[model samples]
Each structure stands twice: as structure tokens, then as C-alpha cells.
Target chain A: MQVNGVEIEDTFAEAFRMVGSRILITACSRQWALQAATTMTGFATSVIGCGCEAGLEREVEPEETPDGRPGTSVLLFAMSKKSLADQLIKRIGQCVMTSPTSACYNFLESSETVLVGGKLRYFGDGYQISKLLGGRRFWRIPVMEGEFLIEESFGVQEAVGGGNFLILGQDLESTLRATERAVAEIGKVRGVITPFPGGIVRSGSKVSSKYKFLRASSNTPYCPTIRSLVDSQLSEAVNCVLEIVIDGLEKTEVGEAMRVGIRAACLPGIVRISAGNYGGALGQYHFYLRDILGGTLG
Target chain B: MDKVILRLKERSNIPVEAEAICPDLFLTKSQQEIEELALYYGNKGRRLGDFFQVQGERSDNIVIEGEIPNFKKIGQGMSRGNIHIQGDVGMHLGALMKGGRILVEGNVSDWLGAEMEGGSIRVKGNAGHLVGAAYRGSSRGMRGGEIIVEGDGGSEVGELMRRGLIVIGGRAGDFVGAFLIAGTIVVLGPVGLRPGAGMKRGTIVAFQEPDLLPTFHYNCLCQLSFLRIYLHHLREEDLNIPQEYLGGFYKRYNGDTLELGKGEILVWAGQVA
Candidate 1:
């Protein structure tokens, strides 16, 4: 199938089953809220190297937050429940607690939860005060600036990660433009996050590598410079490629994000849209490119 | 058909022990059985039918219509359902209640909701002393629940409360929140002397300047995020909290140094930051 002159590859994007959580970081002002959210999601591009994948979901209005302050919501995903819990404690404790006039709260509601503030309360050094309001417990730890408040637990649930699509173009600028458009469109999809830098990954990786120590290596088939040396998947007209990876709280949301992203990436100079997979093995979720593009865009 | 109402037959000056008037106990009994339930009228074993007229039963919703200032233990140890009182009620109104709601349209005497583990009690008029407090020798009072009084409250409110929320929308008498272990007491009007006197760990919020014990020391003048959240929650609960109070700074006083020194009393400082 083709969409706006761009060929749609008959393949699927393989996504692994993971655990995810959403947290709200509120501060005295919008600037501080964004700063804390940005800092908490830093260096969290991929689970392979970063131990988790995280990104800012959206900016929340003061009226929508628990503390009636400007805030932002962030989504984090990890391969295991234990890893997700550990990452929450480390990132929230080090990044959010240290930010000025900041407070963190669990935005998601699930039966299963991980103790975040319950463990971070130790930072109070025997001075933390707990408040139970309307069945929810919050801890207030005195800080140099005043006090930092956080919810005692955060909800975590099964999620999908590595929902991605690749944009192949005739040139570098056109490919980057298409990739950016795709990212901008994907941002409108709730419960999903594009974890890579600028929401675009220039160096996509393959599962196998020549080095024994490396679990993944660069996608040599899509590399333009060594097109003649490797078994290239790209046509002679295609010169550059960029990938947009998505992690979402649900499989349907991930598929919806991929559908919008692929449709938005089918702009001028873009040659084809393809996805990465391991011969229909490995991951539990698979987003078929043609199947997703066949549906109507919301 | 909406309720199991009990209308008083006559005005009684003698105290009545009506512990069997709980919604949990009446949920499965017939109207005749509910009237047949026992009660103690001034130390004499009596029938509930001898004092009140019972209507509609086998439900968890109860309504009492009378000014029984001598009726005690009305909803004692109830776990679920609702009880709506339309007149003045005596002491131990909801003592040791675990779950459900008790809404009073008139005044309540002392020991209201004492030692309640869970549930909520809302009074539209004044409440006597020891509201949500521990019994004479119990270690903890009001382990979990909420008590919202829209009118004046007597002395020693929320004393020894371990975990819960007590909101007094009007003026509070002396020794409010004394010996609080872990809970919150919010008095939206002027409070009496020695608030949070011997609190080990708790919070007491006074809208007007309060006379505190000498052991409490001035801490800081700053914004409290938790207070904003709590006030917002109270607003949702239909409490008439001002918008400025939800976004204002408070005078934090670290007190009860005679005890743990972790307790704090936050007096509203208007809109100043």
C-alpha cells in the first residue's frame, strides 16, 4: 500500500511487554515544573543502555494538578517491575526532590503499586510527616527551601515498548523534516512517548552484532554510506533514514500513535515507511505497517 | 420507603443507651424486630418501641427525628451504611465506627466519633468537647475517618487522634488538638488556648491567630503544598474555604518540643508569600 506517494512496507514493528508508570511533577511555576520534568527524563532514551525509557507526556494546567500548581506529566517504562520501581526511586529522589519548590505525585491509578515516597521519606532523616487525606497518603519532608511533598506510592501496569516506524527519504533534510512531522503528530496521542532525542533516532540498531560484548549494533542495511558493501534494504533512490520509537501504556494506544506518525511522515521526498522486527519473534506486540495505515486517522 | 425512620414518642429527660440503633444492625431486621431491639432507659432495660415509633426496615439507611439530648451511643461500632439525625444527639454519636456516613442536622454532644476507625461524620451545628478524641485511657483516637463540623466546637477537639482529618468550620474552644499523635485538625476560626499542646506528630491549622503553648517555637513564613491540596479537597467536600486560603502562605510553628517536636501549627498569613 502507498500513502501520498510513499510506499508502505508490508512489515511490523516488534514491541516488548514491559511495565510503565505516570507521574506528575508540580512546582511553584510552569518554568520550574518543566525544568524538573526535563531533568527527570534526561539520559532516558532507550532501555538497552538507560535501564528505562522516559519522556514528558504533556504540560498540565494549574487547575488540573493535585497541588493546584503548574505541572507536567511524565511516562516511564522498563523491562521489569523491579527495574521500574528502582528507576522511579532514583530519578524522582535525585531529580525531582532536588528541584526547587517541586512536588511529585502518582498520576496513574492501578491496583498494583510501587513504594516511591515511602522509600524516599528516609531522606527526611527522621523528620518526615505523613498526611492521609481522602484515603491517599502523602509525605512531607522538610527541605532547605521549605518542604517537599510526594505521594507514598505510584501505580504501575503492563505496557508496550519499542513501537517504531522508519522514514526513508531521497535526501537528509527531507528525511529529518518527515521524521520531525511524525514526532509532532505523535505527541498528540495520549499515554505514549517518543523517547529518542528530538523524538527521532538517526542510528537505528539491529538485534545481532559482530562484537561479542555488544547485544545490538547499527542497522548496516539502512546506512547510506556503505550501501554498496552491505546487503542494503534501501533502493538506489533512498539516501537517508530516521526512526521514531514509541512506548505507551497500552497496545492500542501504541498502534494509534504509529498510525498517525506514519501518515504524517508520508510527506514530499519521503520514499517509503518500514518497521523493524525479528522475523515475527522476540517481542509480544507487533504493529503491522499496512494494517495500521489502512485505518482512519483520528 | 427511603429510610428506616425512628420518631421519638415523647420528650425524655432520662438518658437512653441506644447502641442498637446502628444501621449495620438494622440492615437485615424487619421493622417489628427493629422496634423490639433492646435499650436501657436510665438503667432500666426497655424496648426501643417504648420510646420511639419505628418505620421501614431491612435497609442500611436510618433516619432519626427528635431532640434526644440524652440518647447515647446512637451509631456505636457501625461498619457500613448511613445514619441521618435530624435533631440534637447525645454523647458517643459515632464512637468506634469503621465505615459509612453519619450526617447530623443539629448539635452533637461530647465524645462524637471517639475511637472511630473509618467512616465520616458531618455535623451542621455545634459539637461538644472531645470530638474525635480517645476514650479516657485508650492510646489512640480516630485511627481513620473524617469529621467535619460546620459550627462551633468545644474544648480538646481531636485529642490523641492517630490518623484522620477533623475540620471545624467555626470557632474552637480550648486545648484543641492536644496530644495529637498523627492527624490533622483544621479550625477555620479563632481557636482557644494551647492548640497542639503536647502533640507528638500532627498538624493543626488555625485560620485566626491562636494562643499556643510556650514550647512551640516560630519556624518560618512559607507556602505549604500539602495545605493547598488539603484545602482544595475540603472545597470539594463542600466546605466554604476561601480561594486565598488555598494559595496563601502560612506561619509555621514547630511545637510541642516538650514531646517529639515534629508537630506543626500553621496559622493562616493571608495572601502573603
Candidate 2:
């Protein structure tokens, strides 16, 4: 299948099951809210190296937030529930709690919960105050700026991670531009995050590496410089490739993000759009490229 | 959604115990069976049909109309369903209620939501003393739920409350939130003498400056984000919340140092910060 002039590969993107959580941070101003969100989600690009994957999901208006302040919503993904909980506790305690005039609230309400403020209340050193309002408990810890209010617990649920699509172009600049457009479009989708820096990954990985210590290596087949030496998957016309990786709260959101991103990436100078998969051998979720382009995946 | 209406027929001054007339208890019973149920008229045990005119089939929705200043324990210990009181009610109006809702269109006497565990009570008019307060011997009062009083409140409101919220749209009398363990009480009007006295851990937010006791020490002034969240919740409940209050700063006072000293009183500073 083809969209706008770009060929759509028939392969699917394999995504692993992950545990995810959404956090809402509200502050005295929009600038501070964005600051805390950016800091909390920083350095969280890939689970392989960053311990977790996280990104800013969206900016929230005052009326939409629990504390009636300008807020930002962030999504974080981890391979296991325990790790996700640990990451949330550590990141929130260090990043959000330390920010000025900021408060944290759980963006989702689920039966499965992790202790966010419940465990961080120890920072108060016996001076914390707990208030129960509308059936949700919130802890108020005194800080230099005043006090920080945070919900006692955060809800977590199973999610899909590593939903990606590759943008192949005739040159480096064209491929980078297409990837940038795809990332801009994906940012509009809620409940999904493009975890890589600037929402684009240049070093797309293969399943394993020759070094026994490494679990993944660069995708040699798609590397233009090494294409002639390796079993190349790229055509002679394709010179550069950039991948957009996505993780979301659900498979439907991830699929929708892929669909939106792929459509946006199919611009001028883009040769083809393909996805990475382990030949259906590892991951449980499969996002077929044709199904996404044909509007069949929901 | 069957509604059972009970209108006062007798004009006796003696208070009647209508604890057993709750929606959960009357939902499954026939109207005749409900009327025949035993209730206390002052010190004497009498059938409910003897004092009130019972109408409609029994259901989870109950309506009590007429001048009922003598009706006590109107929805005591009720776990679920809805209750509507059209006029003034006596004491213990919704004591120990766990779930569901109660709407009072008129004034309510003392002990409005004493020891309530869950559910909500909305009073359209003034409420007497001890709203959401613990009983004389109980350790905790109004463990969960909410109480919204659209009119004035009497003294010692929210006394020893453990958890929950009480929002008063009108002035509240003296000793509001006294001995409060943990909870939130927001008064949108002027608060009477010595509010938040002896409160161990709780919050008292007043629109007008309250008469603070000597135990409360003045703290720094700042905007409280939690109040905005709480006001938003009240707005969702259809309360007429003042927009200016949502963005204003408040003068914080930490005390009842005589007790645990964790409680705080926030007086609206009128957009000062």
C-alpha cells in the first residue's frame, strides 16, 4: 500500500506489554508546570538504558486540573509494575516535590494503584497533613515556597510499548524533516508518548548484538553506510532512516498514534514507511502497517 | 424509584424518633407495613401510622414533608438510597449514615451529620449546632462523606471530625472545627468567635476574618492550591462558589498549639498575594 507517494511496508511493529502510569502536575503558573513536567520526564527515553520511558503527554488548562492551576500531563512506562512504581516514587520525589508551587495528582483512576504520595509523605518528617476530599486522599507537605499537595496513590495499568515506524527518505535532511513532522503529529494524540529525544530515534535497534554483554544492536540492514555490507532491507533509492517510537496506555491509542504519525511522515522526498518487528517471536502486540494505513486497526 | 411520603398529622410537641423510616428499611416493605412499624413518640412506643400520614408504595426514595421540628433521627444509620426533607427537622438528622444522599429543603436541628461514615447531606437552610460532630463519648465524628450547608451554622460545627468535608455557605458560630482530628471545613461567610480552637489536625478556611484564639500563631500568607481543588469540587456539586476566592491568597495561622498544633486556619486575604 502507498500513502501520498511513500510505499507502506507489509511488516508489523512488535510491541511488548508494559505497565504504565499517568501523572498530572499543576503549578502556580503554566511555565512552572511545564518546567516540573519537563524535568520529571527528562532522561527517560528508553527502558534499556534510562530504567523507564516517559514523555509529556499534553498541557492541561486550569479548569481541567484537580487543583485549578495550569498543569501538564506526563506518561511513564516501565517493563514491570514494581519498576514503574519505583520510578514514579523516585522521579516525583526528586523532581516534582522540589519544584516551586507544584502539586501532583493521578491522572487516571484504576483499581491497581502504586504508592506515590503515600510513600513520599515521609519527606514531611512527621509534619505532613492528610486531607480526604471527594473520597480521594491528598497529603500536604510543607515546603519553603509553602506546601505541596499530592494524591496518596497513583493508578497503573497494562500498556503497550515500542510501537514504532521508520521514515525512509532520499537524503538525511528529508528523513529528519519527515520524522519531525511525524513527531509533531503524534504529540497531538493523548495517552501516547514518543519517548525518544525530540521524538525521533536515529539508532533503531535489532533484537540482539554480537557482543555477549549487549541485548540489542543497531539496525544494520537499515543503515545506509552498512546497507551494502549487510543483508539490506532498504532499496537503492533510500539513503537515510529515522524511527518514531511510541508507548501508550493502551493498544488502541498506540495504533492510532502510529496511524497518525505514519500519515504525517508520508511527505515529499520520503521513500517508504516500515515498522520493526521480531518476526512475531517476542512481543505480544502486532501493528500491521497495511491495517493501519487501511484504517482497519482500532 | 418508588417514593414514600410521610406527612406530619399530629401537632404534638413531643419529638418523634423516625430512625427506622429510612429508605433502605422502607424500600422492601408495603406502605401499610411501613406505617405499622414501631417508632418512638417521646417516651412512648407507638406505630408510625399513628403520628404521620403515610402515602405511596415503599421504595428507596423517601420524602418527608410538613412542619417536622419534632422529627429526630430522620435517616440514622441508613446505608443507601435518597431522602428528601421538605421542612425543619429535629436532631440527629443523618447520624451514622454510611451511603446515599439526604437533601433538606428547610432548617435542621443539632447533630446534623454526627458520626456519619459515608454519603452526603445538603441543607438548603440554616443548621443547628454540632453539624458533622462526634457524639459526646465517641472518638471520631463524620469519618467520611460531605455536608454542605447553604445557610448559617450553629456553634461547635465539625467537632472532633476525623475525615470528610463540611462547606458552609453562610456564617458559622463559635468554636467551629474545635477538637477536629482531621478534616476540612470551609466557611464562605464570617465565622463567629474562636474558630479552630483546640483542633489537633484539620483545616478551617473562612472567607471573613475569624476570631482566632491565643493558641493559634500567625503564619505566612500564601495562596492555597488545595482550596482551589476543593472549590472546584463544590462547584461540581452546584454550589455558588465565588470566583474571586478561587484565585485569592489566604493568611495562614497554625495552632491549636494547646493540642497537636497541626491544624491551620486560612482567612481570605482578598487577592493580596
Interface RMSD in Å per candidate, to 1 decimal? 0.7, 1.0
Which residue pairs in candidate 2 have backbone atoms (N, alpha carbon, C) closer than 3 angstroms, thus clashing? none
- Residues forming the 10-long window of minimal summed lDDT in candidate 1 chain B: B1-10
lDDT (tens digit, per residue) of candidate 1 on A1-298: 9999899998899999999999999999999999999999999999989999999999999999988999999999999989999999999999999999999999999999999999999999999989998889999999999999999999999999999999999999999999999999999999999999989999999988999999999999999889999999999999999999999999989999999999999999999999988877799888888888777321
Stretches of candidate 2 exceeding 4 Å from the true structure: none
Candidate 1 chain B TM?
A: 0.98
- Enumerate clash totals for all models, in the order shown: 0, 0
DockQ, each predicted model: 0.83, 0.77
After superposing candidate 1 on the true structure, give the runs of residues whose Cα lies further than 4 Å from its correct spot: A296-298
Q: Tell me the docking grade of candidate 2.
A: medium
- Each model: TM-score of chain B? 0.98, 0.97
Give the distance in Å from residue A160's predicted Cα in candidate 2 to where it truly belongs: 0.4
Q: Estimate, for each residue in B1-273, the C-alpha lDDT of model 1 and write its tens digit.
A: 568999999978999999999998999999999999999999899999999999998998999998988999999999999999999999999999999999999999999999999999999999999999999988998899999999999999999999999999999999998999989999998899889989988999998998778999999898999999999889888999999998888999987999998889999998976
| Model 2 TM-score relative to the real fold | 0.98
TM-score of each: 0.98, 0.98
lDDT of 2: 0.91
- Measured on C-alpha atoms, candidate 1 has an lDDT of 0.94
Could you tell me how far off, in angstroms, the CA of residue B18 lies in candidate 1 after the best superposition? 1.0
